[model samples]
Target: MNNGKPAPYDARVITHYGVLGLGFFPQVYYYWYKWLDGRYVGTAARTVVKKLLLDQFVLTPPLLVVFYVSMSVMERKTDLFEECRNKLLPTFKTSCIFWLPAQALNFLWVPPAARVIYVGTCAFAWVNILCWIKRQDY
Candidate 1:
């Protein structure tokens, strides 16, 4: 609005009903992380960093790719890869800052059974961030 360019609303990944599906991703991924992370409990700091870094480096890239490409499809765009290229870096950097401490809390203190719910709470906020990111005029 300030810049005179209309905010790109429809291209956002977290569209009205799309939020429900995106919410499922974090919960599901949390369960998958719990299973994949297994029972090898390490030093508290080390374990938190491991979980954060793995989630950052491994999970985020693929998810960003999927998110951008899928959002493009939802937008009825022809060039999905272009959408990914336009949004990936800024989104990934912001995601790192946001998710690092969020996941650290989940890994360190949250019980296994509540992990999904814990992350779902954070995901609720993150979707807002994603909406903000996707709507930027970049």
Candidate 2:
């Protein structure tokens, strides 16, 4: 296609799959944790929210964004909007399927240690997604 290069974003198959892969498993695990751990409540719930949205979000996005941008640059292309669009569904699903429920439990019933472990382990999946996004050629 076009001088041995694929369209800037059309063939981003790796990233697409990565998004889906990264999105599902974590939520699945988190909910499982809830069934096992019996949800957190009161102050515990508030604390979990603070950590995930504030701390984890802040910490993870830059690393992930850097990974995404670097991969684009390596491929000699960059389309931030396209990447965002491609990632939207996976991102939304990840939040809905895993995060919302896991967090509800975290805020209402689960303990802080479990919350941290859940977030930390799930982060690896996102990192793998970033790596997939980075390594794609087209």
Candidate 3:
């Protein structure tokens, strides 16, 4: 039973998920923006839509898998994918709901140089959502 309370702050967990997980995000965001800019050229509407689709369908799924698998490894779970199997769909669904608009705004309004920082800010809230979802059983 989770008791619906967040886990106590643990430095190891923070280090792994926060520091390590986020460390790579800037580069990923930079490249993602660059790729989108290079690949999709035309109307802003078309670009934003394509960016959202790639983000929601392509980037998010693998990222969720990495999150679950990494958390499982960090926790020393016996079955690495058990939590992933249970949680992946729900997490991805929630991610789509959350990220689609956020990324659209990112692609549309936010400047390229600031996209990483913008995403990091958005991630603060998204991380909380992820933590809540991770804590839930189903």
Candidate 4:
């Protein structure tokens, strides 16, 4: 069923966001950031360190797991868990490499109001990757 076709188009498109949750993380990051750093001397320095490194490190692991698993299930893979296992590490490693600089720039420059849109916009490239990952024949 990983044929780039889903019984329903809505479900298919939304599934790319099964793990990513369209706007959820951005909202979470936006709100949750304030609570994290305890009275940092400089806001700019805190935003850079906290947003770039801490957020990514904490979210990446669980996000990868949900992404692989949800994607496999959404694609209707017969071996759902197997598909997740096969793709998890590879995709996660790639995401780590790819998102590091992207997030750094995001935190450094992009305004909080636009961060969700920023990450979601960046996720277009990731959508291509998801397309390829799900396209694999099992």
Candidate 5:
């Protein structure tokens, strides 16, 4: 909702999130977990730290870009980058706050095969946060 108004229902929005949840995110998480599992064989503490670092630095920034851009496109906005330009940093900052500890726990306890599902579970809430951020005027 924007300014306390409910967002108009759009199937594209539903499809966009559905695709992300069913296809894009699962693939990304599976590969990320696989790579982290393969690359970091140190102590669990060290591995979780490394995973969190990569998650916060490498993966999240671009993911936020994608989120904003895709949402803009799905909304049929003329300027795809406007929302991204205005909101990416703040959204990413919020995401860092949310995902850091969540991913740390994911890396620590979630096994390779279940990592995507775990992240999907987390993404349920994260998506709501993203929606809220997207609707904000900043």
Candidate 6:
């Protein structure tokens, strides 16, 4: 097993990314629209940007941290920090890849009800990917 080290693929990169994708992609569109709308008012744009930054960068990370802790607890045992560090970058890349087009479709063309289509489709695939990852042995 490659000098007894866990190779990169040994971790579930796609699943990790998919999970993060749940939050990140949705917010991108949400905030982008908010920003566009807020620009009309002087301070509103700055306020919106600050709030978005806080929500996206500061708040969500802690939420994920909590989720990680809960996941470890619920499962009875696991290295949460290690998993977070190892999977973070891959997850970021995966979100970037999947989120771009999803957002494009959701924000640009789809009506309100149709927005759920992208979420449902992507979320389902992500859930399935995570399920598959859980089934595999490291």
Q: In terms of TM-score, which candidate is strongest?
A: 3
Q: How many clashes does the backbone of model 3 have? A: 0
Candidate 3 lDDT tens digits, 1-138: 669988787788777677445676666767977787678754479777988898889888988898899889878999999999999999998998999989888888888767778888998899889989999997
TM-score of every candidate relative to the true structure: 0.79, 0.38, 0.86, 0.65, 0.85, 0.46
Error of 2 at 76 (Å): 4.8
For lDDT, the strongest prediction is 3
Write the number of the candidate with greater TM-score, choosing between 2 and 6.
6
Number of backbone collisions per candidate, in order? 0, 9, 0, 0, 0, 1
Q: Write the per-residue lDDT of candidate 2 for residues 51-134, one digit (tens) a residue.
A: 456433543344344444445554556575456446544554444555555555555654645764756565565555545544
Candidate 3 structure lDDT: 0.84
TM-score of 5: 0.85
lDDT of each: 0.76, 0.51, 0.84, 0.66, 0.83, 0.50
The whole-model C-alpha lDDT of candidate 4 against the native structure comes to: 0.66
Task: Give the backbone clash total of model 4.
Answer: 0
TM-score of 6: 0.46
User: lDDT tens digits, residues 12-123, model 5?
Assistant: 7789777666767677777877887788854478777988999899988887887778777777899999999999889888999999989888887777777778888999
lDDT score of residue 46 within candidate 3: 74
Ranking 1 against 6 by lDDT, winner: 1
- Model 1 quality (TM-score): 0.79
Instruction: Sort the predicted structures by lDDT, highest score first.
Output: 3, 5, 1, 4, 2, 6
Candidate with better lDDT, 1 vs 3: 3
* Of candidates 5 and 2, the better by TM-score: 5
